[model samples]
Target: MAKASRESGTPPVERAARASLHPVPDGRAPASAEAWALIDSARQSYIDALPIAAAVLTEQDGDLVVGASNRRYDSLDAARPASQPMPIIESPTIVRRLLEFFARPGDELRFEWRYGDQVSGRHFHACISPLAQVPGGNGRCLLTLVDRTTEIESTRSLRAELLHDSLTGLPNRTAFAEAVDEVMASNDGARHAVLLIDLSRFSRINESLGGVAGDEVIITVARRLISTLRAGDILARVGGDEFGILLRLANGPDDAPAAARRIQSVLSTPFRLARFEVGIECAIGVALVGEEQTSGEELVRNAQFSLKRAKSTGRVEIHHPGEAACARYKLDLETELRRAIDQGDLRLAYQPIVDLAANRLTGFEALARWTHATRGVIDPGEFIPVAEEAGLIVPLGRWAVDSALATLAKWDALAGSAVPLTMNVNVSAIQLARDDVPGVIAAALATHGIAGSRLTIELTESAIVQDPERTTKALQALKALDVKVAMDDFGTGYSSLSYLRRLPIDSLKIDRSFVSGMLQDRDKVAIVRAVLSLADALGKTTTAEGVETIELSQTLAALGCSHGQGYFYAAPLTADAARDYWQSQL
Candidate 1:
């Protein structure tokens, strides 16, 4: 008994002797002294060799008793001293689970429990198996415990890493989305707002420095943005240079823009990046959570649409109803446009540019037109911006260049001579910046056996002024090909004479707004006259747009406007119609 007790770390003989209740209460015969001794010896041997904590629990009449327990089991309770041994089955939860396991009579029953405080808790998985073979030990069970603290803590760490940004240690998009959902669901009565912040020209940082420097900038910006938030606001790194914030507004929708301004104010200061102090600007979009905006994803998406608009205006924009729907439609349209470009499903229409004095067709400006599979006639105004945003402008611009030059070749073939027509193709700022505009134009001119002098590349004022140095280089390259360059919508953008003289431009297309009412509006007339005078002085020609009346055309010609294009000449026409129009003009 002493040897067994020493090995098992429990005085089994004393515990069995002190037991008042009988195991054979139903009148079954009790085991012999030698048989009980043998049973105790086997139980001690089973738990003694086990690495984990082990114990034998048995039911005596209506009460529970510990039949045998190993040294490891006694050590499970940190509060108990080594000199004083106590059974680890003292927990009420463990006891209840063990009692339930005893009644189940299963092969094995498993459960988990924790000890100590939540922050410093140790977890354990306990398994119980029936030991029904012991005589007068009908409800006896064997229990073993496996510590699961390390595994549980490791799983929690991984989960935390997944939801947080590694560099900034901020919540990630998924976690932020989840948090937004929870906030909305929990407080339906209160108003909420979602703000999306996009760093303007953020790519310049990464391009000029490196990705490591970009990461540092983002982290610093994240900290600065957090400083402007309220107590309940949730900020997350949602994109490469985008951050999202969820604010529970106390005063309603009006608070949204104010919060945005606060964020902007915090970021107005320059950031000290390495040895360089760089000024950064941001565009913010706010979307109020209406009754209809129930999900976090929807709110964030609406805010994103607003953010896109804000980027253009460099202001804090609030989301309006139907904007989300419009944004989604644009997204779908962009995808379709990409497919259309790949499949050559797009075509161009030509609008005649007439010589004001001679009333003769000088050239045709090629306008892109798309007829959807079902939606017939998609406007260039709609899809052009989408293409620019989605980076599809490069390929689309390439295709347009080739197609326009190819049409010019076909027209030359039909006329039996090189038609004195210049194909004016509209080129986007994105094409100038990202695409090889000069190379593309040169290749198209070469492919169609067309002279570069017969092609004119039209650009918006905004396009030229975006990156003037780069634009000048690109324009110089195009000039080397002997192609003409015309600035479209001349008066609307910067309109700096410095740019006019610096660029190797041949003509300027007066914006339709100024030309539309130039005959009546004195201000419009003056603007047109000034543009014409400037163009003539720079040795460049001028094309007056939106000339709808004979009086307007005569008036423009009298004012020395070299060319005009509008309904007065012709609407944009197909290749066949354009050829016919040119032939008739002859």
Candidate 2:
């Protein structure tokens, strides 16, 4: 009857009834033809729909023997065809382990496994599930292989974009900061350091060369930085012209300085950018992270502060915060500057400007001085900029003009000679732009009973170059009052020649930098000589400032310079001292 059931494709119940009728004591039962057909149809459908390769393996002494494989599995290895047995040793380590575990005889178990291809280096994820057995049948393991290479590569690319600079493909600030945080969190015994690098004069380069050239310069800097960094050190671009570096597992503070020096050496080399050779200099600041628990943000801030200090002091690198005390002191001084001005603690010192050919004092240049209550005499370099930024310069400059006029009046009275006393007052661009400047000068001259010709207003090249047309009208108004006008710090700005030709000026004062350079560089000397000739041709007087030595003074005299003012003649003096010096000279 069972043989008849198998031949006729009877159902499982019908096959069992037939087997019972045979009454086999061993309980050997045959699967019905109907059940066998259903199993084959389900397996074929699953294999056809699955995108990944599917396979079945039998357990044998912790090894897998291939029982069945779909077309996809066979295609994965053309050397092995479906139903062809392959030893576990032929597969990768991960695959072999997965097969060994999944093939164990027990209830169904499932797990995820990864495999790497030896030939293509491609990675795949496999989901392994133990197959359910019929009442008395052997178990098998079902494996599904899914290719994960594309997904993995896409993930890696996204991470790279987040962690790296888009322009130079270097790590960015966020990534570098995270790395530092991780290292510090690990509490590594070795010392670590952060180096902050800021490009010097980058703004000037950007303004002069444009953004394209600037980008080239940045790329060159990145390449040089990469070359300079040692193993385990990471570099990142933090700002427009700022870079940060993290040196992991450093030896100590000594290691930081040496590393910083190497970076500086690399940066000092000239970079060739699009037909222009640009010499780049960087100010470096290094901070060490030792056993001290520090936040990454705090460390970065410290390094940045130190870098600013390095720039302000013109130092190559500064490691400690103490080096920045000068900047802090300047800040404090600035805070007190307004009070100084309000309290009349600020005073003007006059330096006698001598006529070179006549060998006589022609006028006085009014220099602002600050006498701090506690710090004694504060240098103008310390407080003048503060006053300017605080909007105190308007009042300060007016006071300077009034004070100088008063001093000139007093000097004339004491000397008992009209002497045609001229007082030169430095005027900032902001002051010149004020509509009341001409009125102020007129009022000052009227108050002091000094002739307008005896009062010279010194305007820096920057003042006129900033707005030539407007400055010209302002100067013309002052000149209408017969006040002498002199262009100060000449040859240090754009359009010096053009301004000289166009603007109404009574004198030209060469910048001190040019005057100092003229002593050593012949080109500078030639420039000075040419300026003097131009001034002569234009009927304009020339004053050479920063004549600190007798040689410089003599050189200016030989070059036909008309006026000179510098430490060589005399340091700026108090009003009384200047009056006394003029009397003695007379």
RMSD of each: 5.5, 13.7
lDDT scores of the candidates, listed in order: 0.84, 0.75
lDDT of 2: 0.75
Checking candidate 1 for backbone clashes, the offending pairs are: none
Tens-place lDDT digits, model 2, residues 1-586: 0010001134444534433343223666654556555655566577757888877655545444555567776666564433334322255553555555654555444444333344335556766677764443335667677877688778878998988989888888889889778766765624677889899989888998999889888988999889978788889998889898887645667877787788889988888877788999888887766433257766666677778778888675545545345556767876788677677878888887988877788878999987777889877876777666667778888888888888888877876867655789998877776547888889988998888888889988888988888898898999899998998888877766767888889999998888985788999899899989999999999999988888888889999999999987899999898877877787
Looking at candidate 1, what is the lDDT of residue 319? Answer: 89
**Ten consecutive residues with minimal summed lDDT in candidate 1?**
1-10
Top of the candidates by TM-score: 1
* C-alpha TM-score for every candidate: 0.82, 0.49
lDDT leader: 1
Q: Which residue pairs collide, candidate 2?
A: none
Off by over 4 Å in 2: 1-300, 303-323, 389-392, 412-419, 429-436, 513-524, 548-555
Could you tell me how far off, in angstroms, the CA of residue 215 lies in candidate 2 after the best superposition? 22
Q: Give per-residue CA lDDT, model 1, range 407-506, as digits (tens).
A: 9999899878899998999899988999889998888898899999999999998899899999999999999999999999988888578998888999
